[model samples]
Structures are given as structure tokens and as C-alpha cells.
Target: MAEKYLIGVDGSEHSRVALAWGLARAAERNADVELLHVADDSFLSESVAFLSEAQQASQQMLDSETAYAKTLGFTGNITGTAVVGHPIAELEAASKRVDLLILGAHSGSRFAGSFFGTRAVKAAATAHCPVAVIPKHEVSPGAGIAVGIDGSEASKVAIAYAAEAASMRGVPLIAVYAWMAPLTPGLEYLWSEELVEAQRSAAEEAIAIGVAGLAERYPDLTIERRIVQSPPVAALVQVGEEVETLVVGSRGRGGISRLLLGSVSHGVLQALPCPVIVTRATA
Candidate 1:
């Protein structure tokens, strides 16, 4: 079967933006687009209590989204599905068959929490394929793409995905390696310039290794590498403003084994101005 692009839409402006971005990408790749809306079963009781008028309004919104998707040139085999279940579960089950999953950073729903809601976080962390969390703001067309690296196997996967995305979008790839000086006993106050320099050198080496590996795989891709002295999350968010997408591993070397989302990936998803893609080590 041909690969299909799946986009989760919840009848919000932010979701529409995500839909638009997905459509643009699908067109570029000549792939089919599927619009999915997962109605949380937990809301069924509350929705019924609100009256049939509220339910009708919700249905109307879904209809509007379906129409909008068609107007955006996604018709024919383009599918629209509305399933009653937990948002994360539905998407995760459906994502197993899709090539990519696109989601909005915000849905404007009261139940939708900040940074694309908890469901999106879960999906990005556990989905079999890559997840792109579209930012709520407007960004320049074909801006640079940034990928965070920490010299881990998962980070290398993210770097590879970012390299391909940059080549496909015809944009520069920025490989960022963020680092901080290790905290040693009694050395917190006596942290000298030498320690900082050493940390910076290590960060540069990490970035160099990641860039070299990606260059070996994608020799024709344009890449710019950077080693920054800051927290991983802060550096990614600050650099993501001018980029079209920020790619990072779901977990890094500092993350716990059982943890699904790493600190850097979580922070970038929350604060970045552009889309963020979380890639898995094996994927």
C-alpha cells in the first residue's frame, strides 16, 4: 500500500494550521492525507449533559473541517475519520499504519492543555512513526530546520531524519549540541573558566561528530553546525524561532530508561515557534 500522511485535527484554528502544513507536505511528496478526529470518550457524559445543541455544534465543526480539507485539495482517497476514544490511544493505534503523524501545538479546547495537550505528548513519545507538532504561530516559508544532538544513538536517528527533511524542503540544517558544566562537590561556587571551556569543547566535539555522520549519509545536503553553552531545552527553543522545524530524539543520554520524552524534546515542544519532530532510536 502507498504511504499515507495522517494529520490529527480537532476543529481549532491551530489544528487548521497543522492541516494546512500537512497538506503542503503531502503535495510535495505526492502522498495521500488523512484527517483524524478522536472524540474523547470521557467527554461523552459531559457532552450529553450540555444538551443536544452542543453535540450538534460539535458535529457541525467536524463537518466544517471535512469541507475545509477538501477545499485545500485533499479529496478522493483522502480520508476523514472521527472515532470515539481517548485521543492518544486512537492516534497511536492509527499511526502504526501511517508514514507520519502531524498534530497542532494547541487546539483551543478547554480540555486541551498547553503545548498540544497531553495526548499529543503521548503520541509523539510512543508513536511508531515520527510525529510533527506544528507551532501555533506563522513562520517563514522554507526556513532552516534544527535538530538537537547529545551524541546518543537516538540523537543520531533524529539527526538523520532532520538531514532528510532539510534536503527535501531545500533548507539549511542546523545541528545544535547544547551542554552545561557538570556540578561537582564544592566546585559549584569555584567553577572556573577552565571548566566552562572544557564543557564547550566537549559540546563542539559532539556536534562535529553528529554533523560528520549526517554528511556522510547526505553529502549534498546543506548543514550548519553549532555548539552552544546553555540548557538543551533553552538552546533548542531559542534556535527554533527562525527554523521551520526542530527535530530531536524522544529520549537522550541524560533521560531515564523508562521515561518516554526527554527534557529537551519536551521543552522544545512547549516553547518552540515552529514545528517539532520527535524521532525514535529504531525508527
Candidate 2:
């Protein structure tokens, strides 16, 4: 069976970008595309004309998105559906069975809702599969895939996902690990150059452990491991800017905040220059 991707559409240019990006990816993967829209009844008053008109408007928006997908050169099966409910709830329920779920970084209008808020955060955190957040610009394919790591199990899963994606794209894989030594501003000179080098070496070793055995799994993949002495979010954004896609674990586990996107992941999500995939760790 062909792979399946679900995209949340809301008739905005952001949604348009998501549709185009999703379709292009589907075209490459020969996957089926499903466009979903939630018709929030909160915008309607208790009137007959308001309800009927709202339904018509919702249908038109879905129609426009369906037509837009065709123009993006997607030859696979495309299905569009509009359900009446909270946007987050509807999308969450509908995305459970798809191979991937995609949405624009922003929704409706500048004031309507934000993809960085509860809707996207919760959806991505709880989604059964992977979620791709596409920005509101025409993103042509760039270099390879980049994955953020910090030696967590979630990061390991993200690396695996990114490796598969890089392999499929026939591009190199960039494994990024960001770390920093505890130092006081004025006391920085206390640590010798050897100490800094040791810190870096430790970080590099952790990264190697994180990416260990991947070469055997994907012999054709060329992996470039990057270890930087900086915050995780900053390092990821800097490296991810040059790549076509950035993949990270959806959140971190409990104690240190590692499940799929913790605070660091959220920061990267807000500042990322390109598309990002927040992948859940599978059992």
C-alpha cells in the first residue's frame, strides 16, 4: 500500500504552502494525500443562514485546497474532508491512522491562531505518528536532512527517522549534538585549553554513541556528525537552516523533560527557518 499523509488546511496562504509541500513530498514517495479542515462552529451565530453559509464557505475552502494540490504535480490519490469541531480535536482524531500529519506554522490569520500554541504543541505532542510543520513560503528542496540529538532515547529515534529520510532523498545525513560546559563569565580563564578540548571531546564521544551502528543500518548513507558547544536550540537552528528538513523527537522523557518537544524543541520550532518534523518515539 502507498504511504499516507494528512494535511490540515484552513484556506490561508500558510495552508497553501503546507498543501504544496505535502503534495510534493507525496509525489516523491508515491503517497496518498488527505487534506483536512475543521469548521469551527464558534464563528457562527444561532441562525439558519449563518449555519448554511458557514458550511458552504467551509466546502469552498476545502475545494480550493484540493485544486491547489493537483497543480503541485501530485499524481496520487488526493482526498479532502471538512469536519465540524474544534480544529485541534478534529485534526488530532483524523490524523491517527495516517503515516504523517502536516500543517502550516500559522493558521487562519495573524490573530486567529498560531501553530506554536496549544493546537500545534498538543497535536504534535500527542499525535500517533510524525507531524511536519511547514512554513508559509515556497520551500524548494535544499541540502540533506538534519536531526537534533542529546543522547536521549527520543533523540535516537529522531536520528533513525532522519536517517531513513536522508536515505530516501539520497542525500547526506547531518547528525547534530549541542552541548555547553558550565562556566562563570569571569572564571572562564580558570579552565585550561585542555579542559575545553576535553569538554568537546566528551560531547563528540556522546554524539558518536548516539549515531553508533547507523552506518550498518544504512550503508549507503553518508553521515556528517556535528557537535557544537552551544545550546541545543541555537545549535539545531543554525545547522538546520542550511538543510531542507530538521527532525527531532516529539518530546523528552519526564525528569529532564524528554518525551518529544520540550522547551528546547519548542524554541527551535519557533525559530526554524525551514520545515521541521516532530517525530514521536515508537515503542
Query: After superposition on all CA atoms, what RMSD does each candidate show versus the true structure?
Result: 3.8, 3.2
Model 1 weakest lDDT span, ten residues long = 251-260
Question: What is the per-residue lDDT of model 1 for residues 150-232, given as tens digits with 9 covering 90 to 100?
Answer: 99998888888889889888889999988877667877987888878877888888888888866677777788988887888
Model 2, 60: alpha-carbon shift in Å? 2.0
Off by over 4 Å in 2: 46-52, 107-118, 138-142, 183-194, 252-260
Instruction: List the lowest-lDDT window of 10 residues for candidate 2.
Output: 251-260
By how many angstroms RMSD does model 1 differ from the true structure? Answer: 3.8
* Segments of candidate 1 deviating more than 4 angstroms: 45-63, 74-77, 110-116, 252-259
Q: Whole-model lDDT for model 1 versus the true structure?
A: 0.77
Highest lDDT among the candidates is held by which one? 2
**Model 2 Cα RMSD, Å?**
3.2
Per-candidate local distance difference test: 0.77, 0.78
